[model samples]
Target: MMISRLSAIATAPMRNGLSSASMTSAYAELHCHSNYSFLEGASHPDELVARARDLEMPALAITDRNGFYGAVKFFGAAQRAGIQPIVGTELTIDDGTTPPKDRVDYDRWGERLLLLVEDKLGYTSLCRLISMAQMPNAKGVARLPADQLAPLSGHLTALVADPKERLPFYQEIFGRDRVFIELHDHLAPDDRSRNQRLLELAGRYAAPLVITNEVFYATPDRHKLHDVLTAIRHRTTLDEAQRYLHPNAEHYLKSGAELRRVFDRYPRDIV
Candidate 1:
């Protein structure tokens, strides 16, 4: 099984709406956050690539918050692994006109989604957005305005986040097609609520559903390490900071059969 899995990753093909590709085969991961998500995440670029290769993922998207510190490295690793690299960012949107320095308050509007880049032009635009978001040092880390993201629409793929922070603005300018309502389940109460809200918004806005893992580690066993990183970032002790710990550590690269079970409630295959 392991050798066959590695073979799939080594020989996976790219698809751009091609009808020839079978639905049973889907080896891609979209919302993976490397250590570039500041000090909050545990996995490194090379580590992410290695995990993807082990799982036989054909393509992988890197959507770290605030910066693209590992994009070049991820690109090279994916290329070497014979997999496609999709570059993007998980932006923090400030819709209330006030940016929160505290991570908790900013969770709703600030920590949402907006990923774009189409070819080289799209890549350039993503770089610009990241630069703008980080320009204001007082903006409380990885936060961006709606106008800042306006230039990003239509240039790259936009995954509407679970919080729907920027979905209203993206829907206004780029319509529903360019925006995807991303769904994630962390086996947590908050995650489930956020995912349900995102699904409802997708129906209301007529956006496509794109399932994502929002991964930060390779397996559930890394939960303790991830907890340490989160504590380190928050400047709090690991055991003391209970709120930030992920309820379940199933944020790893799940197999096709596993993903099918998780998202079977929805129609069609989701990556």
Candidate 2:
């Protein structure tokens, strides 16, 4: 299906009282990856949708890394389950920094940014950005230069994955209203420090903050399989993939109440 059509289906008004005002006030998962992310995501789009429905989430975005491969499926599933689907892609930006000397280093290169489509124009812009990143790049490495992203910033909202290092460029190109500073805490040891820094950046730039869970799987129990998938993507075994593996199994989708508990200080962002 065309992405625009799929997006239309996903964003259609909910049926069966699912669009009640109270429900609309709940948190929206804006940065989730599904299996289409190529082993990086553990659950199918339907599974994620079902879980979000059970949690009564108002909206969910299937932002598979670098592509909208799972969007059609996600849109259909959300339509069936009575939730709004937001279409987006998580793209890695090329800062024109030094090239990696080895595979491991390559993985560490490039900052990631989330681009969510607000309208048809944003959807088309997303397609162009993905094409630019993947068309001429080597396998497993897709990126677009920062300058290349400036002109195509219309109708799309950008979320800086890590505000500390990549905020300035996005702020300049997309402007404060179109850009959001993403705040996430996966229970990692340093997550507190990281979130604090992001808050500081948001204050400095006067940018709104949006909370995202960065979901890779539907539930915490799937973390082991997700780790194996990551190992496979890197062409290594779990033992050697330690550096690439998530430290804990906390990257699963969390309910609105759970999110409030974790981010009680940032009530404005959780919405």
Candidate 3:
């Protein structure tokens, strides 16, 4: 017999909330830039993992731009904290390796690529990108080029980064299945427009979408100190630099509830 009553719906609204908990699984940040990105950042990976633990995050990914100097340290920290460490590298493929003096292929560094490890092979490929970037190159910033990066794509998941230039070409070559166009919101004024563009690219390529905090510090309060460090890097004053051009004091590791609010329209299963 089927009986519908208001009490029935409210009495067991979630069947013990088991499915809900299983589906949630505690959302994680699979893309974050750490201190290994150089002077632009202030906190170390240990600090980042510790913060994630505090928030009760189940997993975290450290995609330091162009270097693996902190991988072992990051991995150990996350493991100790009982958080799954998703090994990754934010590739400086367009820069650091190519030189402006070359005048031919130097137009790429303006673009950045974020690589996340999906498995063991992906982690190995990520290490190769880091290794190649840090090795001797015509350019001084320790970067790689598309030719070198294209082969490694199979072993790792690539997310074309901020001002990502090769995205258009990537869609044509890799198809939509293997790529992820990310939307990072740390409160840049153009964040909305940038996210729109990245999302559009994801649609064009049939790629999935991922969001990251691009964390430079752990909390909002640490933001100002991070700003000072950027000023130190460029030998410039906070007054001189365009606001948000360097570090805008908005970058901090946020919680999944915060992330969920941003992409509320998309279900967890979709993201």
Candidate 4:
């Protein structure tokens, strides 16, 4: 049974709409963070790529927040490891209707959207979108309105995590086939309920579901550092930032077998 299961994992086709020419793994990590996400990410691009390669993952994405700061480094590492490199970003979109208290409040002003590039056209669109968000904002504050997506939605795939009301807009802009409902399970108490809600939304909209660990660090042992980084980002002590930190150490670069086990009931969502 073990051998058969592993074989199935090795041979299963990727269903996340990404090309699998050089990426043969059954599972590919689509949502990831590196140290370039500022204080929010705990691992370097090289370290993340090495961890993914060691786990036998055929491809890994560096979806750092707001920018592709670590993309060049990640691509280099993936090339050396002989794996496909997926470039994307966790874009924060604010409709510009509300005024934030301050420039630093950009983080609190917007909803986050995960975008993955599908081809050269997607890469060009991502660059333009990032520029549109950053050019008019303060140095560290970057957010774009939803109106910016329509022109750039052609070659990109979107993964929606929250604010279910925005899913329909994404479907309209990116097409239902390009918009996916993202599921993340950090093993927290609320994970089950949140994922259940997302599942229901997917069913209602007939959207595909994709599961990601939203990895911050390369391994479970790095959780402490991740916690420290979270505290730093919030400008608070560990005790004070407990509410913002991850509830457990499950956000690591998991292998195909480990991911299958984590989402066992929804195994088809691993892609």
Candidate 5:
């Protein structure tokens, strides 16, 4: 059923409400990863879709790190669950800045950006961009320089996360309406302050704000496995993963109502 639905959707010419803006669900999980993200994502695409179905979500995105490795699986699962599948990627752009040597896995190469396909054109552009980013670099290290994004910015919506300095740049490239400031709060001590700054930054460009939980797993119980994956990615033991591991089990797929409560202060950005 899943495969057939995906095949039919692929053969269809129209998007049929797959774009990010078309996601009318109370809350859309935009920044998500399945096990296709390698040592970082803890759950499979079907598992993630199952959770989204249980939570009554209408749409779910699989923005696996740097690629669409699980897009087929995600699309199939989502379609079978009667959910729209939004295709995207968590692209790491090289800013020509060095990260702290102490940091092992996260952000060691460059900045992270979310690019969602708005149409067939965007999907084509995304494929070209990912190929360019991966082909020139080492096998596992994928990074596209910041300057390379503008030409391929057409038909794609951009979402800026972390290191607010590049938010304005993306806004300029993708245009104010096409770019959004992503606000993620995982109950960390700095979440409030960081999100406050992000709000201020978005205000400067008149860019819209979107709430994303940055889900890496389908349920809270998978957090332990997530920790182990993080440890493996960093080539360290769980005991040594200390600061590298997420402080809480909050990076799991959340329901619309739960997301509403989490971002109650910013009710307007829930969707």
Candidate 6:
């Protein structure tokens, strides 16, 4: 099973959306995951870098879950591809309570926040934050409490992933200028509502709104494989992984023109 999975990932078709003549090369993908995110991501660091280069993206941020396991590899690949590598992590924050008893409980216990490195200090703080979360228990699941994040909010920029009730928590720590409300449309049933709430929060706090694809793969065709990966992570078969699966194949890397179209309602946010 491992060998076949590796082979499938190695041979996954690279999408040509980046090379399309109609692509505008305007927006940067700020939230993306590589295979370093374990079974949740379908492509490698090089694959994502090459795709971003082909798309003419000025920069791409690799915000893998939890750790910076792939940051060095991604940095090297991005340098070679002539794309700016924005180092970041999708940190899981919990209520600082005991571990969840079951998978369902664990799923409900945390919220994700994306932190991007802006300079040397930002990178160092990121490392510290990740260490704080992972050092306590070696078990793959590492998390930090929401209240503990304020001290490390100096040089890093934070993006509230899927912005819901946690907006105030992040805003208080990172401040208005340093925090952004991330918006995405994956064709999910709740996307519209989520974006609406996100926009409202951004307005209420006078914070900037940024668009991110929450990319896990390089193309739309890879969505099936991505779904398989999701099943593997949850220790379930495809048929029984509906709760963990994405609703559509629209979570792939998108061209600037495509991004613009999807986020046309919020023109300033795309800027």
TM-score for all models, in order of appearance: 0.81, 0.85, 0.76, 0.86, 0.86, 0.84
**Tens digits of per-residue lDDT for model 6 on 1-271?**
0011111212111121111222256566878988888787788889888888988876778989888889889999988888777888999887556666543233456778888887788788888999888888647777887777888887777877565667776777887666777777886788877777766666676766566789998888888988998887667899998998898888888877876577554445323
Q: Point out the higher-scoring one by lDDT: 1 or 5.
A: 5
The 10-residue segment with the lowest total lDDT in model 5: 10-19
Candidate 2: lDDT over CA atoms?
0.76
Report lDDT (Cα) of residue 196, candidate 2: 73
The global C-alpha lDDT for each of the candidates, from Candidate 1 onward, is: 0.64, 0.76, 0.61, 0.76, 0.76, 0.73
lDDT (Cα) of model 3: 0.61
Q: What is the C-alpha RMSD of each candidate to the true structure, in Å?
A: 6.1, 5.7, 9.9, 6.1, 6.1, 8.7
Cα error, candidate 4, residue 253 (Å):
1.2
Give the lDDT of residue 39 in candidate 4: 80
Write down the TM-score for model 1. Answer: 0.81
Model 5, which residues run further than 4 Å from truth?
A: 1-25, 98-104, 265-271
Clashing pairs in 3: 94-108, 94-109, 95-109
Cα deviation at 243, candidate 3, in Å, is: 4.1
List the candidate 4 regions with Cα displacement exceeding 4 Å: 1-25, 95-108, 265-271
- State which candidate, 1 or 6, has the greater lDDT: 6
The all-Cα superposition gives candidate 4 an RMSD in Å to the true structure of 6.1
Error of 3 at 45 (Å): 1.6
Clashing pairs in 6: none
Report the C-alpha lDDT of model 1 over 96-142, residue by residue, as the tens digit: 55554574343334556657455676777777877877787554465
What is the Å distance of residue 42 in model 2 from its true position?
Answer: 0.7
